[model samples]
Target: MRNLVRYCLILSVFIMFSCGENTDKKSGENTVEEVQTETEIQKSEKNVILFFGNSLTAGMGLETSEAFPALIQNRLDSLNYNYEVINAGLSGETTASGKNRINWVLNQDVDVFVLELGANDGLRGIPLEETRKNLQDIINSVKEKNPDTKIVLAGMQIPPNMGEAYTTEFKNIFPELAEKNNIALIPFLLEGVAGDPKLNQQDGIHPTAEGYEIVADNVWSVLGDVVEKE
Candidate 1:
């Protein structure tokens, strides 16, 4: 019986050691995965051209790679721009919301900060002054983070149903902000694509894949002019 007791005691210690070894193995595997993730992030680091906007920037109802931002990346690749394009668009985002989150988004170095917001704000019939303030704040934050960063303001327009007075005021916000901030402006984001049913999706809001390509075209025209690097 005493011999049997000693064997069981030894077995328990072996089992405990085996469990400890498995635990350490799992910890080592996790450490390897963590290092791999960090390596991937480091490899992807490059000069950033950030697209900060709402659904249009988010590429709602379309594949992410087909979105305008990715298309911009493709253009950069062809031109050998050697920049990383980050799409920070979110659906239904208002200027106020964007203002709140701009600093966190600006955590990394951004070469170009393309601002595409205020459409949903206008749609909600929010006061023009408020929208202007929020947008200005966002621009200020970006400028503060990267003093040398180029700022591009993408103008947006809401339908005239909001009243001719409000529509005109909303339309005026972009140019006014652009002039105030001395930033490049795209006059209108949906310039050639707005009224064209063929280009817009069924909702008459977001663009189709082909339409997004045109959007990419509009952005590239302005972006190509402002981007300094090859």
Candidate 2:
């Protein structure tokens, strides 16, 4: 009877161990499934933003990944926002060139567009009307392709040396286009960095690394509102 009782106790211990093992296996599977589900949600929520502009947007003096777009991506990551930024900036590209390439660039999955052209055009003394039309067409095309995508027009200001009339028209183009399209507008892309030697490169046209920070701030101020709405 003593031996039989001992045998029964041993069997009970074996059964409890088996039950615990099964429970642990089930819990492990559940944990894996939960992790996979969360990963899928993150992948699906990723937002794609495109930056279309000239050398300024291309990060002429800095590395591609260190540009303002990349900085903005970092900022978004720090804030826990799911986003992917594409830099479509072409060095020396004018408004006309941007217009020509806008269609090709829009072929990608774009959730938001940061239009920062016209600086080259302004420097080249391109007709303000033509620049405006090109920008207008680009915005319209993007809207047509992706009606839900948001457009953020980055305004530019020609140097005072460009003459009052030309500068006035160049600066006004962004606001007019944004207002007409009912899109977000960044009044000035350079803001605190423009004309500041410390922020600009030696050429006095492109921005330095510090200048990119100011540019990011200028963009963020307006983009924050749009992000909040989203």
Residue 10 local lDDT, model 2: 100
Candidate 1 local lDDT, 1-230, one digit each (tens):
99999999999999999999999999999999999999888657767899999999999999999889999999988987768899999999999999989988988888899999999998899999999999999999988887899999998988998899999999999999999999999988887898789999899999999999899998988999888642
Clashes of each: 1, 0
The reply for model 2, stretches above 4 Å from the true place, is: 1-45
lDDT of 2 by residue, 163-193 (tens): 9988997898899888899999999999999
The per-prediction CA RMSD against the true structure, in angstroms, equals 5.4, 5.9
Q: In lDDT terms, how accurate is model 1?
A: 0.92
Residue 114 lDDT, candidate 1, scale 0-100? 98
> What RMSD does model 2 have?
5.9
